[model samples]
Target: MKDFELDGWDDEEASTDAATSLTRTAARVEEERQALTEQALAERITAAVNAARPGVDKIPDPVDPAGTGNLTADEQERLDACVAGIELLSTATWVAGKSLDTVATGRLFRKLVHKLEPERCYTTIEEWAEIEHGISRSRCSQLRDGWQIGEVLNARGYKAPEGQVRELVPFFNRHGLKAAVGVYEMVVQAIGADKVTAKRLRETVKLFPGDLALSDEDDVNVIAQSLAGAIEGATPPAPKPSTALPTELKREVDRRSVALADRLDRGRIPRNEVLTHLLAAFADERDSRVFDVVFERMKTSNS
Candidate 1:
């Protein structure tokens, strides 16, 4: 090879060295900030735990796990209040999860464990996620969603029977809590609070009439027909024959039909009738301005 002059090569090397030094400095500063954050979180959790311990300890523990016939009247009342407080704390954690970033949440979680159980040592969040089957950061994210939705429901004056509230979370999250409250009130009015099981609530929500004018009787009839079909040979009026549809389409229709059947506390409705109602609803949606606009846009873009 011919001899070459490496002109300005020393300056290039010096520039590279300066860049590396800046990167190292940035990394060091980030690490220090993270440590400071964790320390602050730990201190906060410690204080809260210390504050809560006294009242929680004073509340009498249930002698019977079934919580029946084991305590005086006053003791039972105290236990109920104590349990309510615990649930509130759980709700607060879930609400906080929504606001905190991942690293901050992990720090908070670790600090909570330390404050709650000072006698035991726990591993890092990563190790815990690995060791526990099906437990991960995503699960924590979902937990936050659940708590936030539950609080929304509670705020709307629709509290009690938490399972029912939970069943409607997907609906509330999708349609908004105010809309959910409307549907919930209608359902409670039609079925009564005593009959409102999760299955019943979910099925009722599925058939929500939207803008269609469906009264309580119309809804109650669907449930009644479902119950009637469940009984052997106890058929309602025969439905008109359905046109042959694609297999996937048939499966979806059948799924909704079965959901109605399963939700009924008492009677059975024909699958064909359920399909008819669904088709009517779909047609109504398809004919609406929103669907027309979307369809026109698609056609225009394709052209």
Candidate 2:
């Protein structure tokens, strides 16, 4: 009887060990399967991103030693002529980034970035933006989108007025291109494009139930200007000599600079023009009673 009991205990122990071993083996198999699945998914994503961009690999770098930006002789000549034309248009526009001229420049700039990729001159969009615009990659992205949207809007018989193109990007992208264009034309007709303000459009979009959401907050001044057509009619002041301001005044200028940029159309405005306007306003108003009280406080602080 003792021998039989010992045999039963040993069999039970062997069965338990076998079960544990099988569990570990199954876990290992599952892990291997998961790793392979992830690898395949990553490859698919990379291929899709590459496939979405056509002609990326085909364009040669402008600096390629093969000449004409790495093109054959005839191709080189063609690209050269194209490049020259782009430059001429850009120059003629006086570097007006938000204007129609920018559409051509942005298109050519995108093509150039792709062409230069083979040479590894600019490995990423950020690097390209830095070298091309001397601005942040994010800002470059804004300009590129604005340019493309402006071009499309033009084709659809809608002129992208001032900063409206940039403001309407997410709107256009959220809705299909055709639908967005139609919507823009409808909105323009309803409010009159010339009377349309970035702020008004933003508020209008908020009322939209589906397919369009509010993309950004509208600036108060931009809203007022758009409604009044003030910015459209306001001529840029003549260039003036630079003036150094006190530290406190400089801070105020800096604060206002940001506000002014936000307040204008296209989400960007020239710093010089902004400064000129600010300085002129201050100069003209320095003798006003409102400034006298502010100046008295400054004098007291100094004392």
Candidate 3:
């Protein structure tokens, strides 16, 4: 009986050891599977990130086509450095126009011009630019003006295209940077930044005029808000085949016509003062004709 019990006990112990070994093998397999999954996930993420990145076109070396090999070593080195500097300035100019970093580009232009002294190779900065880049001095001046305007706007956490900002330089000079910035903010708030084109800004400046008390911040805000309200509430004028009466003038004419009809019903003609004001309001020749046509029809019908 003792020998039989010993054999049974050995068999049970062997069964337990086999089960434990199987569990260890299963755990190892699961761990390997998890590691493979994580590695695949990482690779997919890397590929997605790379795919989303913007592609940069390689800039060709500007000095490559110059045939500088025939020149002396020192001359070639100087030319290479000058060309590189000019290339940097050109790149910065483009980036500044796009990114609204005009101030930095303007400063870099002056610094590069002084450092490279294009006069050594060409007669003037303008000459070098015209010959190599086809950029005019007037354009350069406009960029510089854009930079000045950018300085004011950037300080207030605002941005505009170089062309749009250039339109405001005169306003800045007349009303000061603070007033200009106020106007810019107001216009942007009213029409949106994208709609603040050079033409639009120029019109706003003309409408507001330089003689107004734009220096006062409160007054500026009030004017800006008034303009903003007008912009927001005004209806887009319908397309007209011929030169149509201005919308505001049309509204005025309608209101006055009703009032004039009431006065005539009471057997009274419009006062001389009233007629004078009406004539004054119809400033445009085409608008005056429209007014004349409407009143003539009114007279013919009433008589």
Candidate 4:
């Protein structure tokens, strides 16, 4: 009887060991599988990020014999250093513009301007940029404004192309960061992110009242939906002689018309008083005619 009991105990022990071994093997396989999956996911994310990055031209080596004529050892070294410094600055500026890294670009501009000032190489960043780097004064201003706009957008977890961000600078300056960010977010939500262009942003921004105050709690989607509805319902006005107004003047009228309509909708201006105010304000015949044309178009759409 004792021998029979020992044989049964041994059989049970062997079965348990086999089960434990199988569990260990299964756990090991699962861990390996999970590791590989995670690695693949990381690789895919890296690839996507790389694909989205803008291409930059490779900087050539200044010291390469193929690119430089024969020179003394010291001359070659000095020339190499000078060329490298210029290339570094130029490359950094180009990358900043492409990557929308405006803050870095602005800082680099300041440093270069200061360095050149004492050496009498250039008196101002604008001069240095134009003469040395071939960047225009307008372009320099755009980059500087981009830095300010970028700060606001980055704080709000948004990214835009430098051109798009530059377009927002005027609105940002007038309405403040919160309002600018709200408009940006609304535009992005309305149009797919990839489809946003400077022209599109400019047009959308013109729809908002310059004085309209937006708070953090404001639902940007509400604005976006309203604008979308207005746009969808709007019909192209029949071209009139007044439509020949200068492009700038026409844009101003469009902005005013939109603002007036928004005010009317929000009850900021009494319905009864709208016409009185509008007529009194439009003393100039040309201004009145343009406003009349634009306002009528706006009224038709809203109605």
Candidate 5:
């Protein structure tokens, strides 16, 4: 009987040890599986972020705070241009409470950076021309796709991502899109101090919504002047004679009366002259005739 009891106890001990070993093995396998899953997820996220190739996410520190600057020669030139633009358009009010030069440099730097890093950026020049500048939509579309034009546009701002510049320029050039770079300077210089001209330009030629959203009349004027300066070399439309002069041609009419209020800060323009040129380009004979009546009245008031 003692022998039988010893054998039975050994069998029971064997069964308990086997069950414990199985549980331990199962726990180890689960841990390995979980580690593999975590590693895979981490790798995918890293790959996605790496693909984005972003620049600095935060606003950069200003180069100066007192409006007096310690910028490099090129940077100083850019600042001077920005300053000239602000002063010329009577937009000095917007230059208040901040370092205009520093702000200008920072913005310019960002533009350069964005142009250099085209993978994550977009160009608005073509869109600006199409929506606001009276450049036909088809022309704008062609410009975007035309290789040389695109090159000129980009080169106006920056060199392409490494050697990519060479290819882009050729493509843009071949497609009849060769652009003279740095036209932004011209834009600021044109239409200086003609505030009313600025507002009309914004209404008629503003291609980008973001640019047009500026509420300050002076600021809008300054920007309009800048754009006009860029394209001052462009062809001006011819004036056409109108047949039927309406009663609104007299001084008392209300429509386009606000046109007379356009100021030097608005983008210093020869208001009637520009209106006439633009009307000739944009309006039908009948519409231009209607414009003549209001224009005659505005001329009388300013006279």
Candidate 6:
């Protein structure tokens, strides 16, 4: 009787434990179902926000969907700003200080207006390229000739020399810029590529010999100042643009002054090429005669 009574108690205990386990499992399943339902609702909310926002590409998918990340008011502003036109233009990283020439300004304004119109929401890379190429012609040629010019241009991205922001200029125009290539390469060439090799340019620009692929800004600035001195004939050993060609070739400049003087010595730099780089880096035929006379005098003095 005692053994049978013990078996009966054991059976009851086992039945109670099993019942408790089943109840817990059911509770867990219901909890999971509710969680999933909440997740679906949150996703719907996110989708609605993204749909209403005009130009944004992504919605923040918080890791804990239910845990509203307790974003501060400022953070919420940023998030909400992502839904408006002000946000779209504010977030645009480039074009801050880029110059807008007569033609370029029109294109930019038109695009900006179109973008702000709410219904129009996209820009093709091709159209951007066309604008880039239209105003920036030598950018293409610099890529072809001077290895450094393109490097500097790309490194600077849309940033210009003033460090405010880079402006757009057409290639081959030579409006007022001091270079044949885009402005960035002009700086690198004006200084030393080693001193001015901006990492930003390196990534986008094609690398070249003495390309200044890894230099700091301060060093480049000093070197550029020195180069300006040399070019102006103020503080150089001399303007040996061949050695100076980094400064010259860096910008893919015509280097007519260097070439003209060089051809005068070797008779290789045709008058046309001289006129091309330095119409003033050279002189007229009368000046040429005086140069010849001075050359003979120097020879006689040395003899």
Cα shift from native, residue 138, model 5 (Å): 6.2
Which ranges of candidate 1 are over 4 A from the true structure? 1-58, 62-71, 82-90, 93-97, 100-135, 160-162, 189-197, 209-303
The predictions' CA RMSDs to the true structure, in order, are 26.8, 23.1, 23.5, 22.2, 21.6, 19.2
Rank the candidate models, highest TM-score first.
Answer: 4, 3, 1, 2, 6, 5
Cα error of candidate 1 at position 166, Å: 3.7
**lDDT tens readout by residue for model 5, 1-303:** 555445355777898999999999999999999999999999999988875433333223345543465767766675665554433322212122123234333443333324345554323443334333455655444333333322333334422221232233332232222221212223324433222232333332322222222222333335445445434444544456776447666334323434644643354345366557656755666567656777798999999
For model 6, residues 90-209, the per-residue Cα lDDT tens digits are 223223223223223455444432333456522543334345445344333222223233234445452223211122123113222223233345455645444543443332222222
Candidate 5 residues lying further than 4 Å off, grouped into runs, are: 4-44, 47-56, 63-303
Error at 179, model 5, angstroms: 19
- Best candidate per lDDT, number? 4
Report, for every candidate in turn, its global Cα lDDT versus the true structure.
0.59, 0.57, 0.62, 0.63, 0.42, 0.44
Per-residue lDDT over 1-303 for candidate 1, one digit per residue giving the tens place of the 0 to 100 score: 989987667987899999999999999999999999999999999998987664556566655554556777777687787877766654555454454435345564464344335675444554344344344676554554455455554564544355565576776666554444555555666677556677877776656433323223344335334323333233334567977798997787777667777787535567678757655655685467655666798999999
What is the alpha-carbon lDDT for the whole of candidate 2? 0.57
Model 3: lDDT of residue 67? 61
RMSD value for candidate 6 = 19.2
Show model 4 residue runs off by greater than 4 Å. Answer: 1-122, 151-159, 215-303
Candidate 3 per-residue lDDT, tens place, 178-238, comes to 6666678888887887677778888776666323554345655665675555555556555
**Mind sharing the TM-score for model 1?**
0.34
The positional error of residue 118 in candidate 5, measured at the CA in angstroms, is 33
Report the Cα lDDT for residue 174, model 3: 74
